[model samples]
Target: MSIPPGESAPNVSTGELNARYDKFVVDLLGVIAYGELSAFERLSSDARYSPTLHDRAALGRMAVTEFEHFDVVRARLAEMNMDVELAMRPFQPSIDSFHDRTRPADWYESLMKAYVVDAISGDFYRAISEFLDQKTREVINAVQTNDESGALLQDRLKKMLADDPRLASRLALWGRRLVGEALTQAQRVGTEHSFLRGLMIEDELPAARNEVSTLLAQLTKNHSRRMSQLGLTA
Candidate 1:
């Protein structure tokens, strides 16, 4: 794909560029693609939990978006002379574990999990891409990485939490459960892929770890505030 002038392309000849691209870009894209592919499968199944036609359609749309993301990553992998499935193979178990462990019980829970996924992935990708060459960065940016479904979910969930205060407790508890599952999968991935796990985001290994920890802390705080704001017991 043609990127605009000045876009950073992968300079494979430059060892530093190649290292950054491989460590951060590859990892981020692979994870993004893996997540989308799994979401495509799981969200299709999860849509059944929607209690209304609109809610069902909303969930269905998320699946569609996930497929689009999968296509984007698949194409990128091809351009890099990598087989998408082979590249994704190593990550499958971790991704599968995450979705399997956090099977949503209801419409709200589904939305809550979606929100968490969106926020965390966005935070990670946006940080990881900063060090890439212009071409590589542009290509990554060109892909649809934003969590639009999460926005829709947030709007719906916020209103629901407002209407039914008790739902705040239920949803916050549900959010924690989803995050816990994701952490479990993350730990599994890190343990399994020592080299990949050491790759830093924002050019700092310590910072990335801090970002992950800090983000989790923030999510927890947000959940608590949301629960309290809705007058629900946490």
Candidate 2:
């Protein structure tokens, strides 16, 4: 991926990379790719709940965009001689569990779930990218790039809450539930994957617990902004 000169990442010494750091990169990329693929599937399936043909088509397009991101991450992994599927395999259970536990009950619920999850993922990726080489960090940021999907969802949700004032409370609770479930799954992933869990400790970035707290704090702030955009309480 040839980024524009203006979009280039900070220069980092390639010599800083070692076998362990390489494993970390491969594993991180694999999980991110798998998450994108899973998001594509979920969004496509959830499109069934769209009330109008246009909405359905729009959601389908969003799903396609997610799959495109998955392809990008997969290509990056392959360039490093890692099998994409193998890289993603370790994260499957945690990701699946998160989705299973947070199944949406309606079109609005699905939209909110997508919004909340994507916001959290974006925050997490931005913070975690610091542990990566410049090129790898750029790849991760590319996958997290926002498009019209967020704006579309935000508009629809704000209108929905306006139409039904009671929805604000329910959806706010739903948002909190989604965050709780997401954090739970994240903790599980860290516990199960030693390399992933040790990314901070081994790299001597900072205390892992403190770093996680900071990540959550950032996610909370972003989540509140998204909720406010949707005319809901945080």
| Tens digit per residue, CA lDDT, model 2, 1-234 | 112222323352333334446777787788789889999999999999898998899889989989999999989988898899899998998898789889999988998998889878877877888765789888988888486777887887888888888888889999999988876666677657643442433344446666677777777888888777776678
Query: Model 2 segments beyond 4 Å from truth?
Result: 1-17, 195-206
Clashing pairs in 2: none
Whole-model Cα lDDT of every candidate shown, in order: 0.64, 0.79
Candidate 2, residue 66: CA error in Å?
A: 0.4
What TM-score number comes out for model 2?
A: 0.87
lDDT of 2: 0.79
